[model samples]
Target: MVEGETIDTASLDGYVPFDSERQQAYIDAGYWRNITFHDVVDRHAEEIPDYTALVGPHRELTYAELAANSRRIAAYFVGELGLRPNERVVLQLPNCTEFLEAFVACSRVGVIPVMVLPRHRSAEANHVVDLTDARAYVVDYGRYSSGFDFVGLADDVRSSHESLEHLIAVTDGETSSVDGCDAFAEMRDERWVDKYGDEVSKTDVDPSKPGVMLLSGGTTGLPKAIPRTHNEYVFQWERMADAADVRDDWVAFPGVPIGHNASLNCIVGAALWAGATVAVEPELKPDALMAFIERVGGNYTLPMPTQILDILEHPDLDQYDLSSLEVLVSGGQKVPPRVVEEAVDRWNVGFCNIFGMAEGPLICTRPGDDVKVQANTVGRPIAPEADEIRIVETDRETEVPPGEAGELAVRGPGYFTGYFRNEKENTENFSDDGWFFTEDVLARRDDGNLEVYGRIKDTIIRGGENIYAPGIEDELVEHSKIANAALIGMPDDRLGERPAAFVELTDDATELPLKDVSSFLEERGIAVFKRPEYLEILESLPRTEVGKIEKQALKDRIVDAESK
Candidate 1:
């Protein structure tokens, strides 16, 4: 017999849903709750209308106001623009209260928002628009903070993608300058809601339907769309809220673009799930971030480790009243132990290391976890029963015993069923039975913590010895002179490939030679084969928008430099 609600996958377009057996298991285990994203907001609005839901550099919004604005915009989407349920819209905007408004508004009307990063150029935007067949393109075009014409980009996408029907631009000015674009204010105007409030209130959004589409961040190719149903997405963030011990009175600051999966799920979703307030700041520089946190009384934040290092390195760090910060959370890449150490020592705040992906699977260090665990491991799965973690051999047939590194494979309530519209990738990345091969290398400790060894493709083989790059990079950053480190396997004729170190020195340090790096690892008892053979001092490492090291860029640079 079918269990609980049967998801009609045909209606989802390219979105894959849990099968009958898996659906029953999740529902029986109490993991799958039939609830839409907006239900949570409406609940909070009714319970705490006067409570602050969101705060930005420009304005503050209470839960009642937030819900009212979302309902208003949602009414405009359906009643005025004629957007139907399940229709897709490309939402490209920076961090602000309006981003939340637009996101929840999409949820309220059962429209799916295709989250597009602010840095996405016409190439990326066009790719998303074409893939999703989005009917509307929403962008924040007022500030010109990045000095790029987002309106022009929208026009270019609308011209090429035949499915795009409407252009919505958010501007501070009373009127919109762009032709064929609607002002955002029209959608949220009080009068519009008063007219169509009854019609929007009667709309029914299925909890089992797709809520949002997150772009994949795979290293090799163009990003694929990751479809998350409302039930699963809600479950994912609620687990995060529980794991991080989020309190309703807390203020959350996410020092990354809201489009990133980590920022969306961890900071925004989890915080709001617990009825906490989210603090938004478009500027991510150290001083700006610190001042924003202080101004908003932000107690919890998730910034990439590099951002934390930058904050620690800032000359005016001591001047900022960051005493309100209670927890500093970081993820996406291996956080240096020194960074963790300094944060705890200086700020007296809890530091949590999280391991997650757009396709689900959230593992995080809790608030009271041992400092060594926080520094060295990305703690146990947040929901042990729901998020089943495994370390499997290269063949993907057998599980590796604890303490041995292998590919991380997961299959459970917390993982996405498959990538949207990519049948080849779906078959290749998932097993016949169901596991999603994460492609990341990890080793489980006896104590239940998991140590990340970086990506499986990043392994270096020197004279038949398999060496993980992240392990060496982790050790390299512990050196007094090194501020940041990235390890790449450089081409070598003698040994298939040799590990090379790309390092950024600390503020007070000078030059560090290859011999010094090798000797430091030797003293640290790192395996001789894992030592970096060559060293290159760089002013800064190339990174993605989310702060992950761009190793491919470094590899290309090293190859060209070696050839020259």
Candidate 2:
């Protein structure tokens, strides 16, 4: 028997629930429904079978094909592999159709899919496996440009983890099984689908249970497991789709990691919820993205700030026809207002700034907003009536004056209640009253909009003056020759710490001297003390696995340069 086949739903523990009052109020407001991923797939397949659901570089899958493939894979997991309900399966594939198939398959059989990025090595992979006690890992056999052997990495993880029992390989080659590992192709084969299809179809699952585990981009240590139920996760996507004004005719291009919250839930999930097609790209190369967008009639996309900058500076940008793009959602960091303005004027596209996290409470600029608001602010909460946002003191208890800078704390129907199995973090990060501390410093504008200044830890104190990195970065990127900018505090013997800047230039031959930078800022009325004391030009900014500028890496480079 399968794990969830005979087990009681109430007996499944380890998931934290929202307060009864808040949950009830959300339900009363019709913000949440008893819906699951399986339900969404089934509904779309039955209602619009010929509609394209997923488009990758290799193939395009219709809604009917997606539903059938998911059921077949679920059958293999339950009947052939004997995966129990609630057992964790680590999915470490790139932006491909297989990732979606695996996600739906896990949902169909009541198994929890722990999404891991393709870039995760043994260190991160082992930690996730040990954290989730994952029963199986689905990896690819060097199908991407990185050329890393995912099969070998899966084997290494299996060796170190006691709970790991299966290694399913997705290969580009014709051969299915390698050694004793099962082939992903075999799971979708007609024979296996015919054999176990009915049995897997008989499996029942609860809609309110934990549906997936997303890794949090924690500032301090290894990523934490953020478990979101089917209803809450779907609510987020539906709300996002409405805000972005996405329609069934839209084609969304997701260039970022499909495992990240913004790309997974907001971009791809939102598109799918609207019955739109998702054009998946493995990487964020400017040329490839522009071509793909032109080729697929891509009407919507959400690219990070760095990616936007690259595309804006691409030499061949004019060669591609991007007129089909309707909207471009840029976030994951401070989006330069200049980029937003230029993208609108240059490409004739609508732009929305999205401020969100894996923990939840997505604040996005709507399509109807003024261009200035779309360029400057991250907009209001998705569901203003149901979501609560407060600018509070650093202690996280006292509310600050309106339009004043303070810590941002939020609570909503879509947000997660707590991190999995981590009581210390929960106690430290979440309030007893249920608000989750975002650790970001924000201020409410007089117009009732929110402006993110920077993170609490992102401040640079030079002598006694506080310098906000985003403030400087936002100004620096306006320079005609500067493509991207990041500010970090470098150690200084005189002032305890002074600000340093790492910049990617639009023209490699052009140099930005310290004097020129000082002159530029002084003309802009920037405070003298807040000016960066050191500047370094680089080919590109170092980015984290999730594509945010890695400030620590920049700091390390500064330290290494000083040491040398």
Candidate 3:
């Protein structure tokens, strides 16, 4: 049976319905303007036709050009492809100008865009297709260097997924020879828009329904789908722009995949909302990124911790001119205090810590914050007056005392109410009153900042003692010889589990012994049991697609070594 058959048309299965009282309150307070992304793009195009809206390595588009291209694509989708309003389309493209155009076009025609990472293969792609009952799959042709044939992948998806009808390819190199596939460039034909522009323009758009679907970043199990309405999503970006101090004249660079929430909403969405320019780089190479920033006079960017560390340690760092960079924001994991200090001192740049999830409530350090606050903690909620953040016990209902460590639960205008189609998980994660439990363990500092201890699941239980991985990892990273550090719990015969250190050294020739590690932690006042018992040196740590260190992968490696 189809997924949406048993679900209400107005409130789809994968989409969580908004609370009526909160919705009305938000609308009345002017937090939600009832405006869609289509409205934002159209208004910008009319008011600032000549403003440069999107820039990539090879091409740049003005607001007027973006609007026209979106309209044409919308017309082709509706008129030629016979796509109905609210149909789901999977968008799996890299960071480029075409990604922006295709996404806006979906919004323009009332089609729901389901975001999928470009690195995702058949396993992930098929799951999304089956979950959403998607009608189309959009991808880029031969653009990635991963050596996988995207055309072949698309064909494979079409063959397995019976609901998917159209395979759209954005050609960068050679056009696909696939018989039924459509070229994305051809969809820009003016003739199609001229013939069916009126009908496509009249497509019914309901602000109450899901406009976009974002994938969760959980480390365990399949990623959950989180849907957000147009009004709420737009309000989120608008507020993010304000909090980040994104200006109209600033050029924003997004180094991560455009499909990720931090990249799409906090970086790209914020830039467009402020009438600024967005510079897109498909790859995250530090050398290429440095050149792009120098060439475009890029003023702002949001990068992961690994990217920042690479840029700081680049061999030819002095060769480029990156003086235009004013604000640098890092998220997706805890930003090492040493990395933050180095970036600010060497580059004379302002570093901000951004902590957020795909579900909602972004906490960021602002320009006016004290330097220590910026370095030590992820600052308070962006909209503290409107958003509610609580430190609660594991039961997720009882509130903990201030400055105590517990699970982080949040409720806000920008946060989603529940997971799409997963009522069982929702009942477990969310409270009866409306708080969405984030599973992350954080404590409120006396200065009103948040000190994130790792995830509740990430805690290493040795015998009966609970040891937070981030707490140990943070101390280990501060060591002069360690470049990066990750702590994972390995099965122990005596204790239930023991902490193991996976470290990437600053000098490859250097060797760090377990005794030395223990001495260093002792000097730093860390408890004896909390210190890691085993030390493994590696060239590098395994990271997720979004650049987070995958602890589960490290645990598996240790397990494999023991089995041998």
Q: How do the residues 425-486 of candidate 1 rate in per-residue lDDT, one tens digit apiece?
A: 99999987789998899999999999999888888888888899988888888898998899
**What shift in Å separates residue 54 of candidate 3 from its native position after superposition?**
0.3
TM-score of each: 0.96, 0.94, 0.96
Evaluated against the true structure, the overall lDDT of model 3 is 0.84
RMSD of candidates 1 onward, in order: 2.8, 2.3, 2.9
> What tens digits encode model 2's per-residue C-alpha lDDT throughout 232-327?
888888888988989998999787888888888888989988999988878667888888898999999988877787788788888999989889
Which 10-residue span in candidate 2 carries the lowest summed lDDT?
3-12
lDDT of 2: 0.84
Which scores better on TM-score, 2 or 3? 3
Give the CA lDDT, 0 to 100, for residue 10 in model 1: 73
Clashes of each: 0, 0, 1
Residue pairs clashing, model 3: 14-420
Error of 2 at 319 (Å): 1.5
Best by lDDT: 1
